[model samples]
Target: MTHPAVADLIARSNRLGADARNTNYAGGNTSAKATDTDPVTGQDVELLWVKGSGGDLGTLKEAGLAVLRLDRVRALTDVYPGVDREDEMVAAFDYCLHGKGGAAPSIDTAMHGLVDAPHVDHLHPDSGIALATAAEGEALTAECFGDRVVWVPWRRPGFQLGLDIAEIKEQHPQAIGCVLGGHGITAWGDTSEECENNSLEIIRTAEEFIAARTAGEHPFGPVRPGFAALPETERRARAAHLAPVIRGLASTDAPQVGHFTDADVVLDFTAREKLPALAELGTSCPDHFLRTKVKPMVVDLPADAPVEDVVTRLRELHETYRADYAAYYERHATADSPAMRGADPAIVLVPGVGMFSFGKNKQTARVAAEFYINAINVMRGAEAISTYAPIDESEKFRIEYWALEEAKLQRMPKPKALATRVGLVTGGASGIGKAIAERLAAEGACVVVADLNLDAAQEVADGLGGPDVAVAVRADVTDEDDVAALVDAAALAFGGVDLVVNNAGLSISKPLLETTTKDWDLQHDVMARGSFLVAREAARVMVAQDMGGNVVYISSKNSLFAGPNNLAYGSAKADQAHQVRLLAAELGANGIRVNGINPDAVVRGSGIFAGGWGAQRAATYGVPESELGAFYAQRTLLKKEVLPEHVAAAVVALTGPDLTQTTGLHIPVDSGVAAAFLR
Candidate 1:
């Protein structure tokens, strides 16, 4: 008889899968096993139940389950051959399973069988997954789990995976499970309930550890909304195209699929110009490979590309990917290593379109897709801790080509949007903020320049006239109410906000000895606290919109290097810079990008340099106001005063499509001022 708790286990696993789907783009996966003695054969047998392709677990049904003969799977490990024979092995296994009235086995069946337990389950829980993808992930894992768990370095999944796990099991027979490096976890138990409980326990433990170590960590900044809403027909078409691909990759049967029309996280993350570094680290779980490939296939269809051309382009992409895979393998393969598998991509992420995953059955595909989606969120979280450092390129190539890892690739539907998309900037009034806003608009974005100084913002906006346009708004970034209203206005004015330039700030240059408490409060309120308020509102809107976005802070070079006379200004800017780093980590998962721009000696109409040096004071420096510009220029390698336009260019570059994978970075626009100090 089926275990009484099997239903509950399935139900919970499905729910987790669904959560992943809603949160990220094809980001997570789930599986369960049943060990029992066959009544007819009177032999010990294990029935592995994994989620089918194309559907999430939250609403998964029986049709989503892919049943594998565990004993037969275990037998394959003993007679393993090189990677070239993986297809033959899979076909043989499929034939055997078919004879028994079972559907196709999960792509990860071999790895799952290696656990040597009655039931095993895996997932890329957001918190832990994020932690695993960081630069110091291994160290962090050790600090979190201590000796309770064994950390396995990243390895490709499939037959080789089976061998690796078999080896691991031999070394740590009592090990509750393993955390795949640059990936997620695998937990096993004597029963399905035990498996679920153990998975939960492991995740909870990891979460506590991360929270304690990185307290107050958040994403770098706010994301702007782009386009109020996508047409329903477009949304449905995208979903339908994605569903089949996910189902096929996971190797599941019939699967249930769902889509989020107004997902905040999706919009917020997508509106950004780039992906956070954490997302590049690796898949949330090694098992996720069976659904979403290690990396997504980025396609940016042009506006004029016909529908047929788009489809043809997708096919070309698939072909190109295969060729690339072969080349990568040829360049990196060692004599002793097995050849990589050539089929499938676990997940396919198409900007503007959506994401997709494939499986043998709906449940498995859905679970795998969800795992990919959750990884996006987790990667965002990790960005808050530090930039994610996945194994190096050579290592990624090794894993991607590993016969074990290659097994996870699957065919998927195309996503909307191109690999690169347009980005917009706000608060392009004047000063540092205005410069950044202008720079982004100068790039490919259709910029909406908003500021309290409508005329000033409009002037800059008018200068950037094109199909990719720039417009102005009279926004007061310091007012939360105004900030919220600004978001709405931008949504209505521009299709939506893709990039947010939180460059608006105010400062009173005064020594701490003479500064009033009110002055200090004002500094904080405008630069630090005001930035927080704007970011919060932006996040709320961006997350709901389902488009990735970018956020940048126009902090001062004073944030890092303090000049004696500017106490209130320096302190406030310092806080603003810190806040950007924190926000980058928190919002990365939502696919929102955040960063800071620290500029020095930016000469603009705002007049930070109005005090003409008296002839005596000028003689003290041995230079007149007329020569100050030349004097400062002579001090730098670039030999130019920091121009508002130059600083603006840097801001635009940071917020533009070129830097999509960077977040929480502090770029100095000081013409080598900080570098000079180091020298």
Candidate 2:
């Protein structure tokens, strides 16, 4: 059970975090002072409950807070060294734990614990940051809030800054908060309610002051003629084409997932003539630039440019950005500095399209894009009221490569095998397709679930992990246009195509003489032609990405075995079986591995079995409908009934790291049917 004061602090944090205008995702912290019994001494002890390191205030819980003895926390003030060694104080905070160390304390813990108030709120809201980044920020802060909110000059966050703020708090008895110059805002009160109100007052007042003064000023200037966002369809089409190429470049050092945004603020900024100069100045807030990078690589071209020409230029731009970033690292890096993580830019801005942000996974990439937007809001506000002035480049370098920041990165959990992979699974709404989608998602790959049933696909995607791990797209595999669109949707949804599963198929059980032309065409077009179209379209994206990919075809045992009453389906399966070998030999130069799975009569929970094929097969085999699975199992040496999960497991193995050196291989998940084994 949570203490009432702690619960109140959490409620206030969530209220502020939920509103983007109040703060960005994971960009703020809050704290409350409370009393709790000391378990060891059996006496009451004043404790500080502050949001811990790497926690987002919006979703914070009791476990996400650090509980410390207020007396011990304040005692650190006596031993506080200078600002140069302030990072050591963070390590020293472990000794101040009240009981079991709840969570690792953030640097902001000092600011909260050292303050005289019982409640504190520190935020990076755009409105406050705008005022913080303005050239005349200190004076403007005074004009906006008078003595109620004071201004503190830019000082790197550490124990010394905490002391500085504490001194300011002591000096200004009437002040409710202080705006952090070139950073954000901090507020304090005797109660959680008062603290929250003070924080809100700072944000709202800053917003109003900026709004009144910059009412008619066009900070970003007018939109350039050809730089405005293209029509919806045109922009999406362009994005789909360029995303794979951009993702490939961004993943030069490590694989990354991507997120795209065309919000009005982004468009209004990207389309402006002054975008280059403003973007070159970089972001003002540390949280904003930490994810978005020091600056974005601006795509210098018309939105209406030819696709081939645009792709060529994008490659050139990526190369230049990498070189410039490398130079920047060389210019400021000390011997003790952590190695540069990557030279690739996290954010990519195209004049008429929008922004593309990349990270090791989907959520990270989305947050990066959102943070860049916050930076944009800060810039717009600052340029309108005063010249935008962020911290110096050297300061950004110090924070970016700080040993503590590197340690935080190192603390992240090891990625799963399929992390950063985008897999497109056809017929994914049910049966084997759904199983494969879910399995890939479990292994950390982003799955695009495609089926004729949009609602069913969405349900499967939602089950997998919603938009972050999976997305749903309605597609008819037999149609070339739909197959192309499906591949495009995957690239647009999660950067590029890293894996493709040709699982959308059907069967018609009939004697050779009784099989109609339509039956043959349906099976052949869907199983054979559909696989070809999907592979062909996805191959284009893979080659653009320059990243090796996997393509697994769900071939059948009937392809090699002579089964009576099966004509069209068997022939189509044979066509698919051969496709694996042919495509493997052709695509090997491009690092794409083509493989197939042969599963005999997967009747348990199979869509084909439920769609009347089971009855037809049972009648042909002279067995009861319910006994068909057993009959097929009995024919195998192991006598095991192959389920959808078995086939999905096979798909994961072929696409996983273990099978990197194996291609054009067909694995049979048919409970050991020696007759259909690959030679």
Candidate 3:
């Protein structure tokens, strides 16, 4: 059973968190005071239910709430330490738990517990933060709300800050909320509805204040000449080209997944002249700063610059960024400080192309980009009213390296086998390609599902969990330009291509005398040339990334078996098989492994079998079309069927860590087809 007050609190939190205008992801906490019968005491006690640490309020559930005895929480004042030791209080919160096995309490718990109200909300709404981070934020706060929302001085979030806000609230009995300098805002009320409305009032008022002050002023000054966003085709073309290079630079320390967005907010900001100056000052809100890092690297080159020139400049800029980051770490770090993480910029802004953000995985990368956009909004608002002044760099370093933040990072689950790897699978919409996409995604590799059928590819990508895990790309592997763009899309969607599955193929069966040039060319172009094209483009990305990669070709047993009336398909398969060995030998020096999977017969869920080839093969073997699979299975020594999943398993094995030292080898997924064995 749920308490009505807690239910109302959860509902309130969802409403606030759901709107990006109100709060960023997991950037706020809400709480309600409720009376519950303590199991042991059999008497009513006040329980405080607050959104727990790391839980996003938008998707919050009862399980995600930290329930604490309000009395016990308030009793903490007896053992309260000074501001210098406030970090220790976070651990102390564990003792105030209402019972065992609930979401762990968060740092903001103190803020909610100490406030003398049944409902409390602490949020980092961009609008509220815009006023909070302004140079004259206190004056602006008074001017905006006329004491309805008072101003609190800058104080890092902790037990002492909670006490500070409480005292201010007590002194100003009529105040409903207050804006924290260089931080965000807090609001409270006697009821959930009152609290929710108060929070909105503060947010909306701050926004209107900034808007009235600027009154349609250009946020980033006039756009520089030729710096506005490029045409849709050109912007994306540039993004695809530059994404791999940026991803490689961002992965200097550890492999990272990348996300590229040309959202109007990013383009509008990056296209303006103030981009460099504002980006250098970095983000204001702690959540925004934490995800996007201290600052972003702004590419000063024109978006229309020569591809080579852009690439060259990005490399140079990345090197400088790394050195500067290292220096920043050295200047602020103390003996007790955590070791420097990485010197790579999490966010990169290209003029016209938009923003590129990176993280150890896809969701993190995407959220980082979103956070920067929020930061940009905050900057625009703050600049409209007054100077945009965020916390000092030293403060950012403290928050970034805080012991509490480090602990949270340490608690994250271990990455799956293909953790930061990105895989591009041709023919990914159906058959073995679809199975391969699902399996690879399950193992933690972000997937690019490419196929000629755009709709089917999208279905598979959606089933694999949307853009966070998989994205669909329509491509013709036989076309060089399409193959190149497909590989680039993988880089743009993720960080780079770490695993390449050349599974797009077709088959044709005909007697040597009856086979036309059309049949031979079609089979060879799709099977042999397509494999070569996809592998070559993937290899280029892998080489630039400097990360060793794996390439698996889904060849066929027909490559080695001499079957009657199978000349064209057999020859194309042979060409694909040989290409695998050749690529293995060439790409080996670059740490790129090439391998092949040879399946004897995978009739079920096979695109080739579904497309007239199955009937032709059945007729050739004098078997009914319905029993074609059984007939092919019977000829194998093991007398078992080889399925699409079987071939998919082989693909996973080839790219998995177990086969790191094994390449240029074709693993047979056939049921003991002795005739198709590698000679």
Candidate 4:
């Protein structure tokens, strides 16, 4: 006979699921265990009634509950060969249900059975998930709960996970519930009301913690209000794609996880070029790890991107995720080690778009989805506190390759593009400029090489290998007309300019007292004034184009410190440093990004050193040309002379999509010069 509380429990479980569905496509799941002893048998029997598959909790019925005997499931562990046979597992599970062969048990029956409590309810609440994404998520949880919770690192769900939990219960008999890493939470008690209360408390605690932490901080800062919301059709499509995953991971009688779009925040953060750092923050909890992974795949969609394109892009990300997972595994795996299984994420968060979570049931999926939202907040918070530093590549590999960790990878769709769009360079002629120009072109952006030397620019353009791939332009950046011409040339050639590098400058050696006005003017003309000119012209084009742009100014260590006899060059470069900040503010309204690159003494044979400065400067320093190079090299933290190529890479980073919203930033390409200043 059915227990009296079973019906009430199912109703409450369905309500929780509905709540989840309305909130974030969370795929939340709930279950109620029958605690009443059989009057005739006079024996205790565990019966868990979990939500059925493919049903939404908001509109659930009695038929949705798949009833199963908990003890029977626990005993079947010894009978199965390895628990990989889903068909057999399903058959055996169906045998113990109330109907005896009607509907299949929820995929998370095993997971629910692991909890010793009579009733267990799990959900991927948005607040709870966000707190779990940090590198110190466990600490965050502790701070939120103060020893009322048990934390489990991410582990693949199903038999292995269930078995592990069962063992944990044996060790810690009084443990209440668990929060799974990269996944979601599990709350249990003797009654459905008790479980629900516990789950609610967890959500409330997490919400309060996040609110306290972000009390006075603005995620996107002061910006325009009343932005257009995402289209309804597009939102539904995204929701549909994520629903299944969320449902699959959840443990409810009906999938009730809600899904909402925070397009404004997502877009603003992405526009700021902070996605990579945000993604590195990982999920809110280990349970989320199974859905979203440690990091979410970021994509910048055009305002006009079609629904089909968005979906296609998502599929592409999944494919890339698989490849990345495989590569990561290969990098750290030992010969005798077990290989990683699955290569898909439990959750996929598209900034400025939406998020997707996958699971065998609604609760798990909702948990994953909620975790994704939490991740965004935590990432934003961590960024505010200090730059978020996720585990390094090696550590990521360790987690991705760990047998337990690998099990979280799921089946996913394909990836979209391998390269970004648009590029710019200041001194794109020889040495570093030429190398950077070539690198970006290879990655597939129509390149514009701006240089004071027209002939050198032409040569670099010629060597770039395609007629439409690169264009050489002449500009005395200090001259407004020339700077305007360079911008116009790039726009005419490639539709519009998206990147600019203020790289044309000369370094001269002269003691402060001995420096003449003529020497200062010459240095200031190209290094300081030229940078402003180029930035102004580029900003105009970028703003008009409406696609945003990047401006990277190549400054030098002389800007940071006074090298003996280099007074004029140093002063001019220092002016360029200040220029980056001014331009950042000026063009910020137009979505134009600006930054500066400061490189220490780079080796000769490059454009910056090509005009006989290498030999002359070397001799004046009282050392041979080759020995002078070594002398400068030995002075750095790395004891390696900064190369033109190193500076070129920095230029690419500043201009690339990888750093879309980053502006007014200064990156020291010196091995450690500025660092020494701090020391």
Superposed by TM-score, candidate 3 places the C-alpha of residue 342 at a distance from the truth, in angstroms, of 0.7
- The alpha-carbon deviation from the true structure for residue 269 of candidate 2, after best TM-score superposition, in angstroms, is 0.8
List model 1 lDDT by residue over 1-679, tens digit each.
4444457556766655555422233333455556656768887666666554444456666665566666676677666677656645655456434125333455556666667776666666777666667777777777777765677777655567656765776688666776777767777777766776777777778776656655463453443233222454564344433332332222222211221222445434443444433333455454443345556554445323344555556667666656665676677778856656544454554444454544332234445545565656666666666556554556665554555334434444332222122233444666655566555544444566777778887887787663225567777767877776666554433323456666666656555687899988887887788788878876765564445567788787788775655688788898988888899999999888899887765544433443332232234456875566566567667777787777677666776557889999888777777442421
- In angstroms, the error of model 3 at 249 is 0.4
Per-residue lDDT value at 351 in model 4: 46
Candidate 4, TM-score vs. the true structure? 0.42
Count: clashes, candidate 1: 112
Best by lDDT: 2
lDDT, candidate 4, residue 637?
A: 81
Tell me how many residue pairs clash in candidate 3.
0
Q: Per-residue lDDT tens digits of candidate 4, residues 269-374?
A: 5444545555645553333354566565555564346656755665566568667767766877788556565555554555434554544322344455565665
lDDT minimum window of 10 residues, candidate 4: 247-256
RMSD of each: 24.3, 1.1, 1.7, 23.1
- The alpha-carbon deviation from the true structure for residue 614 of candidate 1, after best TM-score superposition, in angstroms, is 94
The local distance difference test score of each candidate is: 0.58, 0.92, 0.91, 0.62
lDDT of 3 by residue, 1-679 (tens): 8889978988999999999989999898999998999999899999999999999988899899999999999999999978888899999899999987279998889999998988999999988999999999999999999979999988878899889989988999899999998889999999999999999999999988888887675867888887789998899888887887888899989989999999999999988878889999998778887899999998998867888988899999999999999998998998888888899999999998889999988999999999999999999998898889999999999888888988998999999888889999999999899999999999899999999999999999999999999999999988999998898788778867899998998888899999999999998999999998988889888988877899999988989989999999999999999998999999999999999988987899988899999999999999998999999889998899888888888888888878899889998888998888877
lDDT per residue (tens digit) for residues 1-679 in model 2: 7899998998999888889999999998899998988878999999999999999988988899999999999999888887888999999899998778798999889999998999999999899999999999999888899999999999888898889899999999999999998899999999899999999999999999889877674888887778899888888888988999999999999999998887888888988988989998999788988899999999878777788888888899999999999998999999999998999999999877888999988999999999999999999999888989999988999889989899899999999989999999998988889899989999999999999989999999999878988999999988989988998888778888999999999998999899999999999999999999999999999999998999999999988988898989999999999999999999999999999999898887778888999999999989999999999999999998998999999999999989799999989899999889877
How many Å off is the CA of 186 in candidate 3? Answer: 1.0
Which residue pairs in model 2 clash with each other?
none
User: Given candidate 2, what's the lDDT at residue 526?
Assistant: 91
